[model samples]
Target: MTLSVTPPGTSSGPRSGHRLAVRPTRRVVAPEVRRRRRVQLTWALMVLNVMTFFPGAPHLLPIPGSVGKLIAQGALVGALVMALSVNRPLRVRPSVYVVILMTLAVEALLSSLHAEFLLGALFRACRLFGFALVLWLLTPWWTRRDLLLVRTHLLMLWGIVASVVVGLAVAPGLAMTEDRLGGTLWPIPPTQVGHYSAVAIGLTIVLWMSGLLRRSVALVSVLVCVPVLLLTHTRTALVAVLAGVTLAGISLFTARSRVRKAFAIGLVVFTLGDLTLGSVVTTWLARGQDTAELGALTGRKAVWEAILAQPRSAMEVLFGFGLSNKSFNGLPIDSNWLGTYYDVGLVGCALTVMLVLFVLVAAWFRPQGPHRALALFLVAYCVVASFTESGLSEASPYLLELTLAASLVYSTPTREGPR
Candidate 1:
């Protein structure tokens, strides 16, 4: 006897007269699907922040420049949070929010006394909201997959930045490194190389240490980039990268003394490199000395002194001079506390200091899996580099990336299972 078997969905025997009851196709939502949704929302916010670069025009408004940027950032971040939490409740981390508010208050106090258009700085400050928002969206909650995605983006950005720097270095009659590398255009200036290299090296170290990349690729990248860093002659950049990578290595390999020793050896080589190349080091050192005059050949020390002599009133000291002081063509404003003090005042400077401290602490203390050490290094290096660069301002590309990365680092969550 031959028997025919009907498919579950198809009718058989008496069931042929009725539509068969097909069990509903169960929708199995993988955990990754939910995670991807969060990632998408996070990336969308990042894209929006990136798009602001295309807008070109400085967003100056009555809301104050920093405040306006803040509004824009808040809008994007708020949208992202809302989207991510259709089912899950979205709660702001109190410490993060407090830091942000303090930063704004500092900006506000500075705005009241700023000599130039304080609104410009205000807008700039506001714009950074995106950076902070990015932290909230990506960190502590970020999975290994999300980190991989971040590494991909970072590597691409690093390649582009590196190519730009190298091309400019080789370009004929570029005149000013800052003009070509730090300027706002197709290629940014080298002004914030410290911040840029810090994050790059930090990420590289994280990937290598975490065993995320094949040894060959990581080794090659480190080799190629080291020369570029040297050629750029960005002392602060080197410092940032070394500090961050070393700190990260220390934190990540706390139990592995050999690895820490290796990292220390690398740092020694990196630092002593300038000494080995005697002529180059001497020349760069000479140039640095020449550049130290703060005002009228006084150097930054002089500028700081001049600022110190300004006034004693709490309001004047705290709020600042107001933004309408001086306007320069092509280049953005100077990178110094003097400029900030002259424009915004003591309160602005204090807030600025606090903001830097906050990021460094977060990087230093935040609970990331393998990335904890790396993030700390990046944050520390950035803080140190900011002393000489236009950190926390749209003027620096590296600052933008570092801030973005920091935000992401903090926002991402740790992987649940053991390594």
Candidate 2:
């Protein structure tokens, strides 16, 4: 039938050889493998997103009787997602995750032995651990594009905050500051409000400097956020916001640009004016026996006084009595140094300090790219805010959200580190 002979290097039919010759074929990753990789990545991202939801904050989980139920539900959900991703090629490293676990350990040890709401604290700590895990999984190689994306994301965040601030300014009864500053979004405490606001403000400035927003819009939005600070009635928050703005100005400045210089000067003036006004109002509102006033200036002096009067032992110093009891009438221990010390004692406090140090170092050295200045400002604000607020604790969802946001923004890939 005179079949045509094929060329030597090409074959239209399969060949069998005693020599067991092998031929190269194009490598195609399995569709299932790709889908699984995508799922794993998505799960990791969801872990971070849920953590940012601030699941542990007071208002979000205010169930007094069924608190355990809520925690169990969260744990189960986390477990399910984790199990789904178990065989995926994703793993969390130690350095980025240890601090969170340590925090939980410290909380548990304190609660089991001394805290009033030990179970509550443990539940909250679990949420924080989840947050840390999400951060570790997502931040391995934040890039320049990532930094830009984070900056844009921060603008949206600030825009939301600014809108709330404007609402508070316009609404009378809606704006109230509690023992902590609580917001419409998070009715936990005033400190929580301030801490989150400060971080958002810092990020906004970064985005603005990166030209992520229209100058006119950014300018107007910033102005709107200012008056909202007044409504918060949080002297510390107002101060933190202004401080963040000023730092951003300094960072985004050049030797030129008269408007920029003017803005900087104006920010300084505004900050000082706010501080002066707050002090005046604080003084005017104080009655001679006003406990809040006494606590405001000196910061829980009464609480510390109560702690000092009570018994002291090496165990108490190292491992605190826990937050189960609010029995601070004996000594006036401040929440900053006192809370950890009172709950976990000296060793816990030391470890907490170490964790803070690590975060600070990571914040300082971590590449910030176009957002470096903003990241620094946010980190500084967080460090200062932590002193007055239970920032390290997962009890405040606002704080947790802001912390996660900050980590994401700072860790975003920039010419300056991993997302």
TM-score of each prediction: 0.63, 0.63
RMSD of candidates 1 onward, in order: 8.2, 10.4
lDDT of 1 at 46: 57
Candidate 1: regions farther than 4 A off: 1-91, 101-122, 129-153, 162-185, 264-276, 285-306, 309-313, 321-344, 358-369, 393-412, 416-419
What Cα-based lDDT does every candidate model obtain?
A: 0.52, 0.50
> Number of backbone collisions per candidate, in order?
55, 46
Worst 10 residues of 1 by lDDT: 52-61
* lDDT tens digits by residue: candidate 2, 315-402: 6666666543323644434355666566556766666566555555665565533454555566556555655544443333333333
lDDT winner: 1
lDDT agreement of model 1 with the native: 0.52
